[model samples]
Target: MSQEKLEKIEKAGFVLKPDSPEIRPNYERVREAFESRGIEVLLAERSARMIGEKGMPFERMCVESDFLVSLGGDGTLLSLVRRSYAWHKPVLGINAGNLGFLADVTIEEVETFLDQLFSGEYRIDHRLMIAGHIRKASGAKIEFFALNDVVISSPVTSKMVIVNAAIDGERFNSYRGDGLIISTPTGSTAYNLAAGGPVVYPLTKAFILTPVLAHSLTNQRPLVVPADFRIELDTEKYEAVATIDGQERYDLEEGDVVTIGGAKEGARLLHRKERNYFSVLRDKLHWGERNW
Candidate 1:
């Protein structure tokens, strides 16, 4: 109720993925809490569609908001982070699914978390992002950004693709598989982890290269590279598709190239309290824990 407390957060925005019927009650609870603190709340298009309410565009939600809340799992946060990266807004992820890395805050803790937020008890964790582009054989190009990873895969077409990767114009590897994952440190925990890639520290400045169902047995392991390196993947055997943050996709043909690099700006994430990295791994992933 204090003036300073009210001033701590002026304008807030929420983006809810899936926009399901079950999430409405919890959404109202969080909205009322924000309004009680004198914070102006905005909803994204998906959230707007559910309540017969009009919401601002996703890009405007990023630019206009003092802070943004993501209500869903990690995938939802990834979508939010990618869209909000240009505005460099801080995001708080209210996990609506299983245990998540970025969406660490639980729905049950939203009330307490807001109190901690207003009290200056939270810390901001900045995570790196990756930008990529696809250049067709005809010279046309399209660009995209991803907070998690850029995946080049043959998820369709009923055939595996041969993808050749290069680093800074030098040939790196000739991989024949479903595809390859070029992930930021934040994304190292997502598809990258499932593909046998290393679990990089979220704060690290690095990119991970992990092959998906690689055909060759030798010398086909995941590689970690410095952030400064530029990576390119070109396919010439079968059709491939470039997917950004699992949201956007582009078809890739023979001789098409996709270039990836560290983005100019990173994502700023808000966490209510300090959490140990190793402990998070143990709790979220059951890392280093034995069932026996």
Candidate 2:
């Protein structure tokens, strides 16, 4: 939860869905709306190139703008968040695709939302992010951050992956399954949900460890731990790949160690002050609906 209101949003940076030219009209319309409110709109280079407009570099846009906007689906928003994490700017997601869990604001609501935004009636959420690294056998390290989860899964679907888990340097359990998802509370409704993991509130500070298709007699289940504890995972048998936020991937060798923990700063998300998380869950997941 955010306690302070935004201090007069003047300039906003926009990033559109990749390779989608059909969204140019939507982009123009939204850009007009923001301009009408006296907000200077800065388009990212890639998105501008896709839409045939002049644009600035992404780093420059992030630096000059008061906040960032993602005009696409949840996937687009995820990409924007991860890429702009270094800038530490608040992100606003405009939904143009289906199943908009992270990108909740609809196209129709842009005008009204902008009004609320200017009037300081918007909410900014601090969602936990994953700061992780992969230590290779040759002592090289690859570092990355994720707003969702870090998944360790086998490349071959037929072979089960054996992942050894340790908490703070202490060996705990071994997960022999299709894969393992170490998700944040904000990502509980994604792959974690499909794998039978609980839907945790996005504001909660916790790490969710959910196993996908476990092949064990003990019947392994999803485990939620405090964000402070560091988790280490490695596979000894079959080769595995570690995926960050479902967007980036790194091949893991037998001796490579993957370490995951909460990021120092969480991602700041801008939303409607009146938006309800449970209502979104019900609407998206049909929680209380029953077919007659």
TM-score winner among the candidates? 2
Model 1 scores worst on lDDT over the 10 consecutive residues at 1-10
**TM of each candidate vs. truth:** 0.92, 0.98
lDDT of 1 by residue, 1-292 (tens): 1112222488888998675757777778888888888889899886788766688888788778898998888888888888777777888898877768888888788888878887887778877888888889999999888888998889685478788999999996888887899999999988999989999999788999999988777768899998889998899867788889888889998978899998887788888666566787889887788889
Q: Measured by TM-score, how close is model 2 to the native structure? A: 0.98
All models, RMSD in angstroms: 3.6, 0.9
lDDT tens digits, residue span 120-174, model 2: 8889999999999999999999999999889999988757999999999999999
lDDT of each: 0.83, 0.93
The collision pairs in model 1 are: none
